[model samples]
Target: MHKILVVSDTHRKDENFYRVIDIEKDVNLIIHCGDTEGSETQMQQLSTAPMRIVKGNNDFFSNLPDEQEFEVWPHRFFVTHGHRYLVNMGSTDIRREALVRGADVVIYGHTHKPVAAEIDGIYVFNPGSLSYPRQEGRKPSYLILTIDDEGELTYEIKYLELF
Candidate 1:
């Protein structure tokens, strides 16, 4: 099995970011959905997991791609920061884009809220914000996506306090 850690909108917070990385040390992959607030520089010091990062509206000087695609065995994931797709209004545009990219899953973040759903047969998820969470309970959160050797998928959102 492979463990993937997904996090977003860290907004320059270091303590929580470090804690999360430390806790998920066994993860095989790490995806940061932007708004890192300058924390990307410290990523080399954070964890040993392989990482993928996309640019967010707040990541002004970053050279990271605005979006990208990742293929893990039988699944293809479209990853983005969600700002350009107008996620605040709704995910229709984003969903359409992911479909066009032949993605089986879509991961994005921008609203500082966690989301998990299957729209039009594609899984769409957001890991929420590690620095600012706007959802119910206002807990800092992230996502753990586990993919077994046979390609079975299981994903769960985890709050910082509970991590």
Candidate 2:
């Protein structure tokens, strides 16, 4: 089995964000959706594994890609920062891109709210913000996706309190 961690919108203020993640364990992949704030820089301080990332609207990652598309474990994923596609109102462009890329999952972060929806057999997920969260008046958050060697997949959006 593989455990994949997903985080976004860190905006960098929380020094404890890294503490909540046990990257040394059974984690097979890491995905960061952007706006890591200072967290991305701090995140860089510890190189755990190959990470997939995109630049958020407030993210300072100029070198990061505007859109990142990849396929893994027989599951294709498309990711973006969401601002360019106007994801807050729903992303038609991204949906199209996902179709074009033949993605089974579409991941993005920008609105700072956790969103999980499926459209036309395509699964779209937003891990929410690690430093900022909009729904349920809760603390920051992220997500965990699991895929077994047998090709079974499951995931959970984890809300984290990094105070």
Candidate 3:
């Protein structure tokens, strides 16, 4: 079995950043959606499994890739910062990319709002913002994905309510 923790749009605050660190022991991967800004350096300080980080529009780094595609647990996955794809335009932008990559899952960040949906056999997840969330009636959150040995995929949304 393999597990992954996905988060995005952390901005700069570190509060609750380590809320899901426990997954490091059981998960095979950690994925950061984007908008990390200075939080990238902080993430580097963490002790956990491997991580894949994409670059968001607000990210100041010049070296990070705008998007990334990879496979895990025999499943193809696509991740993007979402600026170039212009996700704000519509879901079509991301849906097209997912189709092109032939990925089973697509993850992106922008708009600082959380959403998860599946279309045409492809699953798309956005963990919203951890440091600065734009959505109402909730705290910052992230996504936890579990892929069992049988290839079944299960996902849960984890949020921080730390006051």
Specify the highest-lDDT model's number. Answer: 1
Q: How well is each residue in 1-163 modelled by candidate 3, as lDDT tens digits?
A: 8888888987777656676675335767889987878577668678377789899889876467788899876678999978787887767888888998898899998977787878878888888888787778767888888889888888887777758
Name the runs in model 2 displaced over 4 angstroms.
14-16, 38-41
Q: Which candidate has the highest TM-score of all?
A: 1
TM-score of every model versus the real structure: 0.95, 0.87, 0.91
Worst lDDT run of 10 residues, candidate 2, spans: 15-24
Residue pairs clashing in model 2 are 11-36, 11-37, 12-37, 12-38, 12-39
Residue runs of model 3 more than 4 Å from their true location after superposition: 22-25
- For model 2, residues 9-67, the per-residue Cα lDDT tens digits are 77765543565465335677788887764455557656365688788788664677777
Comparing 1 with 2 on lDDT, the higher-scoring candidate is 1
Report the alpha-carbon TM-score of model 2 versus the true structure.
0.87
Candidate 1's residue-wise lDDT over 30-136, tens digit each?
99898886678688556668789999999999888999898987789999999999999888999999999999889999999999888888889999998889999
Q: Could you tell me the lDDT of residue 19 within candidate 1? A: 84
TM-score of 3: 0.91
Local error of candidate 3 at 57, Å?
Answer: 0.3
Decoy 1 TM-score against native: 0.95
